[model samples]
Target chain A: MKNIKIRRLSKEKLNKPALHRPQASIESMHKYRTDMYEGMIAETVVVRGHGGTNINAYFARPLGPGPFPGVVLIHHAPGWDEWYRETTRKFAHHGYLAVSPNIYYPFGQGAPEDVAAKVRAAGGVPDDDVVGDIAESLSYLKSLPQSNGKAGLFGTCSGGRQVFLVACRTKGFDAAVDCWGGRVVMSKQELTAKYPVAPIDYTKDLSCPLLGLFGEEDQFPTPQQVEQHEQELKKYGKTYEFHMYPKAGHGFFYYDRAAYRQEQAVDGWNKLFAFFEKYLGTTD
Target chain B: MCTGIVENAKVSGSGKGPDGWYPLDQASVSYDHPDHAQSGRAIIIDFLNEAVGPKARIAVELTPESARNLVHAILASLSRGEGEGVRAKDEPPQ
Candidate 1:
């Protein structure tokens, strides 16, 4: 509850129609290219990770030679499952090389839910390890032949908190998006070995602009906590945007669950695209 | 909410698993989001055997109401069988 600067996004900013997206003229020239795949391709691979340990990750990217901006998608608490892989493809299909690494690879992959249960039993992944994994994921994306040397970070749920954590702990990321991340603001008594410190404390180290999507009804990151986050970013004069949707609760973007709110989720996605377009430096 | 807390205990006996059968050595109880429960969140119980890996286990996610009733049922069952269980224990009575 220490004091920090906070600012609510004004209606003028929130009402802004869209982000500046670079045109994709290659879509019109597919008949001339034999090197490109129809649109995009996705596959799983083992990437060198934290402590030189190899970890599994899902990589999705468009099939072209041109330099495409890179994006790293962090899987939510449910484990790296179908949605995360699909989201990676969505980014790649839209002109960015996106990768979502299996953050829980160490626990072994069985059913995503089952692996998630084991991870929960183990008290979650260590914060430092997560930061290292994301850093490596970002590096892997940057090394792609189609990479433009710029990368953005995006994630939902606990993964969203990781988006912020990695942006602050590592460098080279150009943009970041956090969707309904919980526990960014945890009390001292709540601290554990895995999450030794509140992510809010790392505000000053944030290396890139941020985009935050939240459910106004979320109790974990209640509106007050979002306010605190905004204030911290302001105190550091960090570039950022935040959207709090009405009539939405935690995990509202999860289409499979009862919390799904189509309108809000759709809008949140649009805003995310805009944010990425603006910061990832999209090009034709 | 991540809740992100776990209560652990040493457990004996076994539960049927994918591979047929396994010894259960531990149990972890947590209240958090569930993979299949219709409730927004639930109390999750994982009966596990670490030596057999993560999948060697039985798990349940119950709504708060359901969890409460389940607890009551377990207590009632235990109470009703307490005398029999106590008598069967191989111990030196003081």
Candidate 2:
């Protein structure tokens, strides 16, 4: 087997390209916000990660950068969404080289909107596999020139759970932020309960300091469950933080959805950024 | 569905210039699982011992010295065929 070459991408190659085409100026002026969504900061390219798999990732760097710290943004379950993209952009905005891998990309080759359905169609993949995919993204990010050798992990929904997993399983992540992903206890019965099943049972291996945010009113995972997860983390002696908002529900941080709670979402975002700044800022 | 038998493999070292491991460009060739070739990780020490010849100098590209551990795991999976029972080896440590 040929040893995979670990190539570091240059800063120039990581910039989002300007798309000021002829006819699109009128549409670009609309509130759809083309500038936010359309920049091609990273290519839909493949890189060799752990286990020699051709991992797919979207990488973005600071607008005009030196060697900035890096962040691996794991997407919520179902699949990647606009929120994932914005989260990556936010990391880039904060002067970090942010990379988000489409963990379900191997099964879904279409636009981001189509990923959730594709994930359902692929049946359930093991949680370790998902965590492996995250590790690959970290490897890819670390190989980038703009990565500044410092890295962290962040995620929302199921992605949040992944942040915790990567912190425990991988070495590259110096910090982690999990938004509303419960530490599930997986069992044979619980495994079959949800499609694309969640193996919440394997969280004992978490090794890094993690910060988790949850909604008190979420039906799938109640505030009590979130507290239970927090207690479990404490039992493991892992450094972690857990927050429960009284009134928010699932997808509260998602601005595009009707369930959006701007105030709570902003508070969560600020806290996450602060956590990253404190833990990863100096390390990276 | 992706499966293959190991025909051969070469061990190579991380090409981080002078800072890399000694004796670069060793490899292991495998007919099956072309994907696993990139990292050059294997599952058993003796497995690599057999493929690369005993005490054969090989180079690998990875951070830290743990790439050997990763390689042992990967090679063990390939030799087991279909990777079914092999999954247990990676089970989270209790």
Candidate 3:
């Protein structure tokens, strides 16, 4: 046998905590092991969405028989596109059964961009419809045989805002990650028929621990709005953590876009996975 | 961040789409993330005929500066056309 030297990560780097959990550490969570088996499958599947309507979703999961935590991804305002599919697979890579439903399915179908443009012209999907869809998605995850009976929510941009809304309005989600979701703290004048109430108003009803990541320069949910939201969560005594990155703006996690911030996005993703592992890890 | 700022107008015109020429009934202009534009945000314009479904449309994404230039060019061209006695006295069809 040939002698091989192995270098391990330092304790300071591996044990760093992403959030303010005194007892939890991130040691070994991100370590790579060559001996471990790894495989995943990703494809489009049909699931019952809001109002019992059949909708298409990108479903991804590891090639294993044991139970695993599930994650429902609410895609951004760009519509259900390639980025979302890749994200779904990413969650699967981390031992999560992930699904991202096409909320714009009812609007029309062609190319994702065209459908999204139509949705934009129609003034966006109604808040109620989205809530129903997410709730059903959660149910679908729980129903899967490979599920560990625990699920979390993850979303970015407009999807991020919807994550907060769904976490507040629906029940049974173990954890949630909202990445720069705008319109959560809408003003009186911003209210419309579709979005009649702000998601912050439902803080009292939040049923799961929330993790929020924001960029300091984001205009939609500006620093001030994030502060207001944090205040509300504090008042309700909710379990939550928020991190704001400097020199990054909206959609910083999108590597394909110019807004991608490598440092901040990587750090944000680490915190997100840590938070989900803490709240939605497999029970076995 | 999605600006959530959108404006709509009813219009009477013909737009060329993937299929062929279609009668346009509505036009929407919004400031939001573009699906294809390299910029983080853009001014998106969509010409559509809802009766013909989602594909019966033409879409454009422009950067802020380019959108401003387009606005200026549109006004200048309209002014030139009117000066040449091509302007219609009657109001456009609602």
Candidate 3 residues B1-94, lDDT tens each? 2667899999999999878898999999999877679886799999989999888879999998999889867766986976644433453533
Report the lDDT tens digits of candidate 2 across residue range A1-284.
02111111111121221222122222222233435632326445675544567767777776543567778888865456666777787677666778888776665354453344334323334566777788877777778765567788887766766676667666767778877664353334444322233323435766556777777666435565665566666566677766666567665787665556766676667667767777767222
Residues A202-244, candidate 3: write the lDDT tens digits: 9999999999988877888887787788878878989888776
Each model's lDDT comes to 0.81, 0.55, 0.84
Ranked by DockQ, the better of candidates 1 and 3 is: 3
User: What 10-residue stretch in candidate 1 chain A is worst by lDDT?
Assistant: A1-10
lDDT of 3 at A222: 88
- lDDT-superior candidate, 1 or 3: 3
The parts of candidate 1 lying over 4 Å away from their true place are: A1-38, B83-94
lDDT of 3 at A49: 89
Q: After superposition, how far is residue A111 of candidate 1 from its true place, in Å?
A: 1.3
lDDT for A235 (candidate 2) = 62
- True-contact fraction per candidate equals 0.51, 0.00, 0.61
Whole-model alpha-carbon lDDT for candidate 3: 0.84
